[model samples]
Target chain A: MTTRLVEGSAVVAEAMVRAGCRFFAGYPMTPFTEVLEHMAESLPRVDGVCINAESELEAVGMVWGAAAAGARAATGSTGQGLSLMQESIAEAAMAGIGFVVLNMARGQGDYFQATRGGGHGDYRTPVLAPSGPAEVTELVADAFELAERWRNPVVVVGDYYMAHTWVDLDVAAAVPDPPPAPDWALDGSSGGTGSAKLVSPLGTTKQRDGVGYDLAAHYDHCAQRRQAMTEGIAPRAECLHTDDADVVLVAYGTMARYAEAVVTACRTEGLRLGLVRPITLWPYPSEIVAEACAETKVVAVYENNAGQMIDDVNLALLGAAPVVGINGFRTDSSAFGIAPDVTVENLTASVQALFEQYG
Target chain B: MYHRRVEREILFTGIGGQGIQLAARTLAEAAIADGRRAQLFSSYGGMMRGGNSDAFLVVADDAITSPPVVGTAWAAVVMHHEHAAGVWPKLTESSLTLINRSVVAAECRPGTGAVVEIDALDIATGLGAPVAASLVLIGALVGATGVVSADALLDSAARVLPSYRAEAAAVNRRALEAGLATTNLGHPAWSRAEVPS
Candidate 1:
């Protein structure tokens, strides 16, 4: 219940402790390094274990091991390190062991492709994107809950901006109880059975069949759980004046804040406009967005990436509104796809042009 | 009923750890304390040390229409040469430019309006803390623009530096006085200079 001027990284750490995260394993990576440092200092105060893993791969594996042993475990890294941890993440996914992975996204490319998409498979991990300090705190709590409820890994994705920015937050109320390991978790002893039963290996025919049947049931249950999560955990999308507007501005994260300002300005000038901010990027609140598009004339998607979220917006709108993308990818040819130097002024002009065209 | 108008937009630019953020925050807090609606936003990049840092502060009696200042600012306090030059184009004819005399060397023109030069480093060192140069500049800003009252400035300082209340309070008070005392800019014809080259 202590209130202090905590940095964004420190806020995330505090949320982790509140969520009953007892085990932390991570490697040092810029921007994200602060999270590890904060955990190293605070976790021990709460009688939790914090391990500085030798490598990113080892860090994820350590969390996997800890979770299997019935402890609330977590790990974090930057883009490159997250890439190295993908193999272990996939294994954890298959095992249905609940754990949390934080990706403080930075420059994207060969050395740091994990920020973009480097998990080595087609699975879309339940990813929560937080723009500022407040969202960071709220999402961390949501991520832990989602992880434990589904018995799978929940990733809280943040960029350099969210990691470094300092914003005021009040988190004395949202802390959860200490996580208890389920009876099914592997804790080295089989309930009163003298003989050890190995449930991991799937090479033998009988073992393979047993594992297949169990995995199939788990996957089916997981599918239904995921659907409920999508409907239940869908982020509250902010729709500003979209009901009777002709042009809708679509944005998320920090960019959405700037777009909100622009929309306010445009409205003052007598231009009819509104904004749709997708708070949850993973669940991709398509239905909510489609409802907005039904009444709007045109939709413009503004993002820091080169059309990463536009595809999803297009799918949601489904030709109900003419969709245009105003992308801001780094044009410097740097490996990191840091949004090319686009300012609010640049975006204002782009929106103005759309307004004139539609008018 | 009389309609109120937005008075001004000001930008404070300097390197990280130079107290630019603090100065901006104080100004906004002071405006709010005086019962005015003020909005502040800052943009800082990878350069924590010796890197380019800038903060925008907008103050008005009414609600702010936009979060960021769009064009020319009414006044600017530049602590570094690069930031001053980078933002030189955004000055209006009546805009006031406060340059740290220790670092910047630029001739003021008619279009760019008045330029106030002060050796903030010297004044801060004399006050026994070189880091207080920002406070000196802020003090000079209050005196020059009359944006906020001197009493408001001191109140803002106390609120921002609450942790260092006992130790640095006296020096900061003196620094503000020094800023108000030294106004060496000769009156120049106010003309809006063409955008900086």
Candidate 2:
């Protein structure tokens, strides 16, 4: 296998292509822009179509159209751009459209936006928050698989760190086993036949000649599918020193790496600090979070934003442990702009102060 | 010096046009070529000529889990005096710092790390590639730390050069060799890596 140092966005796009993502459309946004750039360059080379849509709304609509036509498709933007696509995303979820939506976010401000979305309905999308470039490479294929498996939009959340960083990766290694076929997709083969299919935001009814609208039944089916996903897709997480530790720090995305390193260093210095990094942010990794917090005294939820994911952490713990929210948001005075102060030293100080009072 | 399974962070700092990002990338790619894990991050301002530009690189034998912004760098390559002030404070006492004597007017604090000042611009100009002063310092980085072999660095540098700029490849090679000849690898403050048991 040939190893090459590559930008994370380029590698992630390659992995998506390998995982059978044949259609991509996105608008330019910082951090997320790189992914779109790579997709535009590489997708057409693989006999796939990549579009630089006029806006985020157009991008998601394009991806929805592509997914409806039986191609594994994707679209993404920064969290700000994602806000504009919420209606389309919710529609896709309700309609059982399977595709990947990437939130190459600016920071961890959008945990609630990704997990508990603004979509108006009893709908939830599986969100994967990868901590670094390597994880992004691995999760791209899994995101696609999970999307198709549930026939719902799967959101992969990352930030500037994951986007701009260059790491050594072999994109080939990231392609998981091919997902099952989309037999239910819209193909124009049986257009005139009575058995011709219909794909819509309204759930399909057993009527070929008449327009059947069954709101109550469709809602029931959507609820049931969401329930099945909750049970079938086990939450994925990484636990370090959680089994026997006094304190457990809950973090995700790029902030998770900062916490991980600080935990290792704290352990070296005899603090008994551990970390719980939720790889799959929704499904929320509640079970793993609960398990890691079982024996710990204090659970610190560190996020780059102003205390978003702490709610999920608190809900997961179910008052099993006291939770403290550590806000680590920081903005660099550069053209690169704002980001979290996700340095190991900064995190270590936060941990030490927490221990000084609560140890 | 170098030890396997441990993370080493290097910060490259200079003005916007100084090739700081490329130098950091070269070290990172060289480490990867030698079967090591590496991550390179670049943060720069909007100004294309004279603004603070920096790049952070983490090299490790195993996966590097550190955030893009490092707390304390193990090593640093300073290319200009303009942005060096802010960089000095982020370094720990044991940081292995190399300054471009051709540009930086004052030396770093005497007690901080093992400071190696090289006239990189002068060296590069003598080799007929003054713009490749960054490569010269990168060569000194390999020589001082032995993090990766000089040959590995040269190969990576050649590979990373854009196709349109291929004409300067020979001079860039010469600059790296000259920088290597100027530095003595002994008395390195940074830990050298060996395969872990």
Candidate 3:
């Protein structure tokens, strides 16, 4: 594959298009704006439509409309805009209409917002966090497939660092399986056929008319789909020297990249340290984390937020080891923007202190 | 201590409107065009001009494991003195320093890596395109570092220019060639570098 230098946003948009994404609607926000801009530039050439929606709610609503109409559609924004789109995201999940969601978050502060969405339901959004630009290409392609597979909304979580970083990568859509068709999708073909199709969150028209649709039964079906997703889909985690390390650093997204560098540096000095980076934040990769916690003495969770994913890390560990939150809230306090303050030295100190105390 | 670094990192610092972003991107594109793995991460304020602007670049013959917010850089390409003080502490002892002497008047420590001061602004002014000073610095950098070829940089520079800015490609090409002639590093860092399979 011939590598080309491109920013992460371009890589994501290219991957989405390669995955057959035909409709994209999003309101512009910092970091997330680039993805929309890229789609606006690329989609029309492919006979697809890209809309710069006036609001995040409108964007998600447009994506929902497209996805219901059998189009590979997507929308995105940061946490601030995503907060406004939560109701529609929940509706998409409940409505069983699949679409890709990009959360180019301001910082890691939106981990909880992504994993445990503000939308009303017992539904959980399958979230993937790619560490760099190269990984984003594959993950975005997989995200489209995963959303279609479970017939649910899938979120690709990132930060400004991941959105803005450019890398030399061959961004071709590589899906493992042939995606199943959206037979349930609504099109004008069903029009004037005396049997109009219904794509609603409550229940299908066929179910309501034929089986006397039960609301509890529909919710149960949604819950079972989630359960099947948990059992069927394999969680991806990148482990670095976790087999024999005394301390394991738990992180994801860009913060994990920093943790990796620090762990590599410490390993050279004979310090037994490693890192566990969750590629899928929602599935949580509890089994792998539990295994690592069994071997390591201390599990330090490093996040750019104030202990958001630490809850998941704790749940994964299940008291196998002491879990500490190294809240690396790196933000530019001036503009309420992101700051690159998670340095190797600071991470090294956090792990060294834990190693010294626990070892 | 062994840092286990395989990538060469370059940090570019300048004011907002000095074309630091474009220069860094061109360097990355040139590296990719030459079959090297490259990564560029840029940070600047929302200001239209005269704000602190910087870019971090990682060019490697193989996969790069270094994070974008690099703790220490292999080189610093200084285009202006406005934000040079903040970038100096990140340079290691073995880091190369290249400065535009016409615009940057700050004194640079010489104990570290090779320090080469090029009169890029004067050179660009002489070439009749004073705005392409960053390109001049990039040309000199490629000549001194051998990270990419001068011809490849010219090709990539033309490719990166927007459609509206297409009129200035020839002058930018000339500036790059002129900057390349200013440095004397002949051999590339690696000889017989196999084409990545």
Q: What is the DockQ of candidate 3?
A: 0.60
Rank all candidate structures by their lDDT, best first, as comma-separated numbers: 3, 2, 1
Clashing pairs in 2: B1-B191, B1-B192, B2-B191, B2-B192, B2-B193, B3-B192, B3-B193
Cα lDDT of all candidates, in order?
0.69, 0.83, 0.84
Q: How does each model score on TM-score?
A: 0.77, 0.91, 0.92
Q: Taking the tens digit of each residue's C-alpha lDDT, what string does model 2 give over A8-105?
A: 88877887888889899999988888999999988777778999999999999999988988899999988779999999999999999989999888
Point to the candidate with the largest DockQ. Answer: 2
Q: Give the best candidate by lDDT.
A: 3
lDDT of 1 at B139: 78
A3, model 2: CA deviation in Å?
1.7
Please provide, for model 2 over B62-123, each residue's C-alpha lDDT reduced to its tens digit, 9 standing for 90 to 100: 87777788877888899987777666767887788888889877744334777888999999
What is the DockQ ranking, best to worst? Answer: 2, 3, 1
Over the full model, what C-alpha lDDT does candidate 2 score relative to the true structure? Answer: 0.83
DockQ of each candidate, alpha-carbon based: 0.16, 0.61, 0.60
| Model 1: per-residue Cα lDDT over B84-110, one tens digit each | 564667787778878888765555322
